[model samples]
Target chain A: MDNSVLLKVNQLKKTFIKKSGTVFNRKKTEVYAVNNVNFEIKKGEILGIIGESGCGKTTTARMVMRLMEESSGEILFEGNNLCTIKNAETNRLRKNMQMIFQDPYDTLNPGMRIVDILMEPLNAHEKNLPSNEKLKRVIEAIESIELKPAEDYLYRYPHQLSGGQRQRIAIARAVILKPSFIAADEPTSMLDVSVRAGILNLLLDLRKKMGLTMLFITHDLSTASYMCDRIAVMYQGRIVEIGPTKKIIQSPSHPYTIALVSVVKDLNYFIENREKLILDGEVDSTRKDTGCTFVTRCPHQEKVCHSKAPEIEALGNGHAVACHCHSNWLEKTS
Target chain B: MSTVLSIENLSTFFKTDKGIVRAVEDVTFSLEEGEMLGLIGESGCGKTTVAQSILRLIEYPGKVVSGKVILNGKDLLKATDDELYSLRWKEISVIPQSAMNALNPVYTVGDQIIEAILLHEKVSKSEAVKRTKTLLELVGIDGERQKSFPHEFSGGMKQRVAIAMALACNPKLVISDESTTGLDVLTQAQVIALIKNLQKKMNLSVILISHDLPMVTAICEKIAIMYAGKLVEWATTEEILNNPKHPYSKALLNATPNLSDPDREVVSIPGSVPNLVNIPKCCRFHTRCPYAFDRCLNESPELREVTPGHYTACFLEGDKNG
Candidate 1:
């Protein structure tokens, strides 16, 4: 109920049923894609969700954007529940929440010109505006993304642009409506390293210019640390750790978070002597275990980690972790 | 150390309708025994093209124009079809970029690796099957899971499987062309560590082609930086990291965000890569080079050694070295 909060997701859960076996004999099972996830984004803050593939980061973002319906929990956007909003109300809120997807190749329509793509969002949201006024706003959006002289790019198709340019057009489409909250799912992962910095700097510039709030989702810890004000590390559909970006990178508490932090390759001399705590196997989302989700791959897993589920324990200053052996590990280390 | 592969004045050109695209031009480097080299560049900078040209895998429109690719004292460029075929898996193999679809879906992972071993070596089916098991285990995959199809393994595991297949024939040189591109960061580190340990243990020379600066510097002993179909700098990891000669190399290091030093600015190099079709005989990176002079605009600089083991192809090197 904080006034400064822009988007709040409370105990969000999404599950899918998987069926197998022969045609005559069918078996069903539940797969928890996003289970009991909680996070909050302030008016102009960026919260990043970091996790490996199939760890429900995308699912959580989709449910928050109302692109995917959640099986349980509430997604409150400025104190309004997006899950239960009526069509008219949802249509109105649509202009305020936009999503930038991962792939630039698939997101934009190759056949359509850049002008039409930028105008689609405005046409849906501001139907009563004059054609000239809409065209002016579209040109402004194109320029805002730093694709200047918008006329040069307005008529060109998506295929005509480079990967970086195409992504700029995609970003232009997202910001054309001047959305306050944007959920960018791996926006720069598809981009090359040299071009990636430009996109990241552009987003940061847009945030300063428009005071935009972002839910940046990426599997790269360095990018998450750079862009996010706060970070949430998810595993097996649950957030294992969440804290301020500095705290998460410097003093991560959870075992899974520690393993993830240790594996991040930086430019500082190859972490050769760094802890080699390599987690085995990928996230198995199909497991219906009642214990901690990361128990299978955790290096410091104890008996308690298998018998009981770990709850989020606050260590201080908005820093929290869900791990059974954290206290003992801290004591042993200290 | 003995040299495993030496590429001398290698140039590969693609004949496009617009004009002849000089993808790789007069690139020269050598890989020593048990050494790992990282070829770093932007997307269209001919990093992959260099690998393809070395392996003699350049397709129809693309041809290796000139130079000698000497592998273990044998010239791959002058080799016949039969000689190249025998040299491919026995001496050189590639871990392709897309591990997800690099494999055949119908064949089991074990059978595919076994097929690779059986085709080049004169081994029986049973021996090949046994070798496949050990190869799978070498990359950290369970030997039993090799029976599963490509779809059954995860992305990282599939990449590991590809690595096992690459080493199936005991190739002397392995080209990992963006092998860890699509995997997660944690998984990428794991796969990279696997490759590193294997290279050291087996004494295998590797050519890692990637755009990831941090990773390329972290593992690879030597670094070769490419900029638009031309190598701008080649040096040891320490030399490249401590004192980069080329402006393109410095710009690349600046562009990559350092996780350890989060406060450093990540500036992107301005201007896109120039179109390669019928490119002028000047420096390809002159358009984006901050200190590009009139000479750089008119004439291309050759890769000349400034220090003992460091090579750079920038006109500014003359002013700075002296």
Candidate 2:
């Protein structure tokens, strides 16, 4: 147990039972949404989990937040296995862990006022606080999110506020508890680009001010490059590559990571060479159990990739890639 | 290069109960033949309304109050409903914003495109189907699966289908409004590349309306930044990226996450978009402008040429090159 580590996720796995076909011809299959995932976050670090849609990034985030139970794994928080904890203990532990969802409109209650929304966590966790003190805490939370003259927005409903404002209120609600760890799942995906920067800046500011460790999940590589200290690229319920953000962006080792980095719309680069480094086919999440999960669409897949899954091989300085053909592909490209 | 479309002082407003919402105000720009222009703006910034105004797509309470939308030497605004109807698919077509809900799920993808072809061109059913297959192939979709319903296809495939449908009648100009809004990175890249390749092969004029700045700048030769129903800046892609004169354009480019400038901190413009119904008499962005002075608060700036092939609407740049 590393004392500096805030949260450790070891061999996290989740299986979903998906049913299809009519009642007369029913069929069921097991889908591994998060399979054998492992990662660690130190205090005050921002670890980004990025992937295409249905690539298990959100699933991994959910399992870490304990919003969804893992099928079998260990989520060690501060040297305690969260899964083995009792219900009452887990509720207390949740005070240090918070999550912000993708859609701010859906996450915040439309009927409640912004003040009430921000105060729910305080009321639940700090029940013994006096009314005046609670209201003071509420105002502090609202002010922390930079909604000027906190009184102006305290009584307004979610519908009355814009998308960015609602997201701020949601962040206020999450950080109202002063959580040490936060899992933000596509927090800015629904926002307009201009408004999205505000939320990202707010998150970064709060992380600096409060010493919060963030698991920022997004589908945009450019954003991940901007906000993350390190990035873990997920594909079909598995992290194919994990490394420092610059390393992943500059020298992506995995085939999927390379494809993702190449697809980023860079104006200067695209004009000089309009050639697309594209990979065909959508991500197939139904794992066959024996082969590499990315083999279905991997551009550099070979005979070895079809029979055995490649283990994560370290390449020094906290960069690792899980692919058998990485060395061969690197040799060819270089 | 000859001009394919010219818009002069285009102003579209909605007479809502709250008041008259000036959605698109005094907007003017021109598109060259076989050129690609990107109209980039935030939501409610009136980029979509401008596109609607060009095609007379606004209805009832919302109307294009005054403008000259000249298409192939004819002012589209002056044309009758019948004339506009005929001109829509024949001269200009649109790939609408959302691929998820824009498509009709009941109709087969092939039939919809074929219907589009049959409506405009004097072609037989078999001939329309043949052309539809070619359009499908042009967008990189397999022509055989054109018979599948919209629900059966993935998000990217549906977007390709939309592109195919937009090109059914070989319209000289295509207006793709946020076509890649909700797609994944790879899908968005594929769609953008497809549009670029199609533009080259067909020599078609394109007006790409989107909030994705990087995607727009990557493909479009010219970029227009819209804020609160006004064209704040317009320039060649290179000039716009390198030397953005308008404060709003500069802030937008700064706010955007660029791969090349990885270490830059994205500074968000303070304040939300102003209410369109009661836009201030002065500059619309004056409230959020960090460098705003008393003059900016009292007067609005006009879009003036700052350099060759670059224009900006800002008081800070002064009248040096105007």
Candidate 3:
């Protein structure tokens, strides 16, 4: 409902029906991939969804991109409820939203040239544009992604380009339409640190130039902290903590957030005598749980955390956390 | 500490359809007893190739042209097939990059690790099984879970199994080539911490080949920075952190986003990693090196000891030191 909000997700849930046991003994179970996930990305703002594998970060992102249909709940983009919208209007919505996937090697068609890869979106969305005009725009898009001259890369196949180059072309493909929003799901995770930095900086630069709002999803906290204006830590399809990037990293409230932040190895000088919670095991999304999703792995879990789900409580300055034992951290943090 | 393993003038080339691909050329580094050496480079920079060349794992198309992989004063490269076979797993074993593909699907995780131990050492099935349980427990996995198949374990658990398998024979030297890769960040850190802890506990020499510079620098005592098939810099972690000699090393450090220093500018190195196919002898990093000079383009820089222990292969070492 907010004028500044570019995209808002309300209780967006996605579940997969998983069946276990043999022919004689069979049982079907509903795996909550994305359960009651809610967040909003303001115009020109980047909100990162940080979580480990199987934490539903990618699933939530796919629902926003409309690549995957949500089981229930609303995806509101610019005052429009995308879920309720007809199929005809959804096609038009595709023009404004695009997603950059994890693997660059698989995203692009190896057989297709860079020119054609950039043109496919345009062909689908803007069919009225003349052939030459489309070609010029493809070149412009290539140049915009900083693959200089554009001609050098336009004719080359995806196989010919390096991983970073392919990812840039992927970014080029995403932004060629000049979409208002981009859901980048671990775009640089596959890249080397050197090239990873280039991709991250390029995304940051593009955000400024294009005035783009991004729902950046990553498992790496350092990367999330760098790319996101606000960070949302996800565990088992639920947001454990959502706050300013600095607040999440420096003074994290949730135990999972603390663990995530502490685990990110950096060249920067280590914080002296910091309480590093090296929690064993990972957050499994499937087994079915009624309480807080992170209860299984939370180092500071209480009796209430196992029986009752904690509601998202505002901690001021747009920061919020869903943890029964958040007060323990708050006391220390204060 | 004594030098556990030393690679002298190692060169591995792949006879590709295009030409002779210089995958790892003149890469030299020594790992001391209980020392953790981080072999870092971009993809195709031949970090993995160097690891492969060490264990004589280079297959048909790729050949270790010339190198001396001296382990325990014996050149592994010159070792006969029988000798090399005997040495592998018993003295030195590799923890491959992908744990998913590393384990045999048909075998139980315990059976796989037990097989490795029994094959290397003169141990009975019962003895091997007991050791396997201990190994599994050592890597922070429950011993009972060893009976589970690879598919039964999660991505992180499978990787831990791989680590347990790698350590089964109690190899004096372990080559954990990107072991933490494909796992989540928290798991990656935990696995890395496990490796570091194991190295100290067992007094094992480790060669951790990866592309993650920050993670490498954080745990690895020494670092060998590679680029386009050449070892650009080899130094202590502190030296690499505070005073990196090679332009590639400095660029890598700069390019990495430091979590502690959030406001620090993350400047990416220009240009992609150079193609090694039919490449001439020159600084492999010249194309991406900002301080590249005429000499960098014309000739290859040999690894020189600029300081007591720090080594670098760059024309602009003087500039770096100054």
Candidate 4:
């Protein structure tokens, strides 16, 4: 295992047996929510997994966090295969891995006081910490998130706080364990735009202070660009493109990646080409795809693209794309 | 340049247990024939309330306390229930925020649109059905799927069906309040493109209300920025995007992460929007403004013209020197 790599996911796949039609006529069909996904996060680097809804970004994060069982493939954390780990060991390992969910309103228990919520993790891990020590740690965590004065918010329930404040408390809870890795799944998507920046900035500040590695998942391209050091663009459960943030934004290779980037509502470019929609067609995950997953929507697709899946081809400077027509596109555009 | 809709001194209030919540206060703007105006704001900044107030959709405990909503030379605020009912689908219509609940799940999409057409027009059922098919096709939905229930259609398709229903009567103006809020990026693009094309073909005036800044800037000809229930800035889309005048507008533009400039530091406005039950006596945004001084906290600023076709309500704009 490379010490620089904090976590690595290899060929991770997950499928669900969805049933349709009523009663006796029900039909069971397999939908691969996540298939053959691969990525890695370096120590203290933020790796963003971005795609449209149901594109497997969330499933990938859940699988890595051991929240959902992966059907096959390897999730290596600190050189350990987390998939085959026993329950007792997994629970112990969870102290270093935490997840922040999208909706703060639903993530935290509404009935519990903020202090108790923060204390639960500490008690579970430490087992015999004194009450005053726990209280000091909770206060320290709340103050770190800037939920000012600590005492005022310590006794309040989640409902008593606004959406922004609730999200701040959520962040505070996630970091209370001093986790080495955090999976923030659209932490700011449910927030108001004005307050969204504040949360994002807080996350960045926490990253610097704690030296944490993150797997930030989101559907919004602009937000992904802002929060991520590198981004992996997923389509139909597979990573179609992965690259540095600047390269992904400036010179996206895959047609699916291009479509995702173009759809970004940039005030400058959108004003210039408002009428041009790069791609269409919704993602149909139930389809048993043999060829490239993005063939149906790829504008530059060829005969080979419909017959066989393309391997991820590398293009220097830490950029890679899984598209057969990448070279052809390069020739045409350049 | 005929004005299709004009709102003057609109102040809407909600009688909550906490106190009288001024959801919208002294909001004013206008839309010309065949123009698209975007109302952009945060969640509780009263963008939706302004749209609801235009059609008098406020229910008990909520009232348009004072204002004039003039639509096509007539004041809609003063129009009676019967007159407003007849005027609704025929002259103005709305595509509500959530397409899933905006449409009745039990009724076929075709039947719903046809029913709306029949209620506002003197057309036979057959004629209404025919118009319904045309309207469905206009929004890119197949006429063959007209019999499908809302559940059968995808979220984007349901939104398109909602659009078809809104345009069934060829209303002169359409108000779409967060119409594409929950749709995915591709679906959002397709729906917005469909609306833009339809608006051009029919020469329909549109008011699009959303908190998504990029989506709003992409399509709207003129843009209005609302903060704490007040229209803080109004300008042509280019002017506002390029040279925003008000401090709140400037913060909003900066807060949005630009695809072109990913490395730029995004500084969020410090405090959340103030509760309207006990709004401050001065500028509503003064609590969060970085440049706010004693004057901003003591005296309220009115909307004043800062440049050609640009208006801002900030004491900083009035001060030539810091």
**Tens digits of per-residue lDDT for model 4, A273-329:** 443325445567888767888877666778998888888889999999999888997
* Most accurate candidate by lDDT: 1
Q: What is the TM-score of chain A alone in each candidate?
A: 0.96, 0.96, 0.94, 0.95
Candidate 3 residue spans exceeding 4 A from truth? A265-278, A329-334, B318-322
Q: List DockQ for all candidates.
A: 0.58, 0.59, 0.54, 0.58
At residue A4, what lDDT does model 1 achieve? 98
Interface RMSD of 1: 2.9
My TM-score estimates for the predictions, one after another, are 0.96, 0.96, 0.95, 0.96
lDDT of each: 0.89, 0.88, 0.86, 0.89
Stronger candidate by TM-score (1 vs 3): 1
Model 4 misplaced regions, further than 4 Å: A265-279, B319-322
Instruction: Give the TM-score, chain B only, in order for the candidates.
Output: 0.98, 0.97, 0.97, 0.97
Per residue, candidate 3 scores C-alpha lDDT tens digits across A1-334 of 7799999999989999988899999988889888888889899999999887888999998888778899999999988899999888988988999989899999999888888899999999999999999999999999888889889988999988888999999999999899999999999988878888889999999999999999998887778878889999888888889998988888788877776676664422222212246457455657666678876666666788778888888999989999887887557646
Measured with C-alpha atoms, the lDDT of residue B191 in candidate 2 is 82
Candidate 1 global lDDT:
0.89
Residue B97's lDDT in candidate 3: 89
Candidates 3 and 4, the one with greater lDDT: 4
Query: Candidate 3 on B24-138: residue-level lDDT in tens?
Result: 8998999999999999988878998898899998999999999799999999998999999899988999998888888999989998988888777898999998998899999
Q: Rank the candidates by lDDT, best first.
A: 1, 4, 2, 3
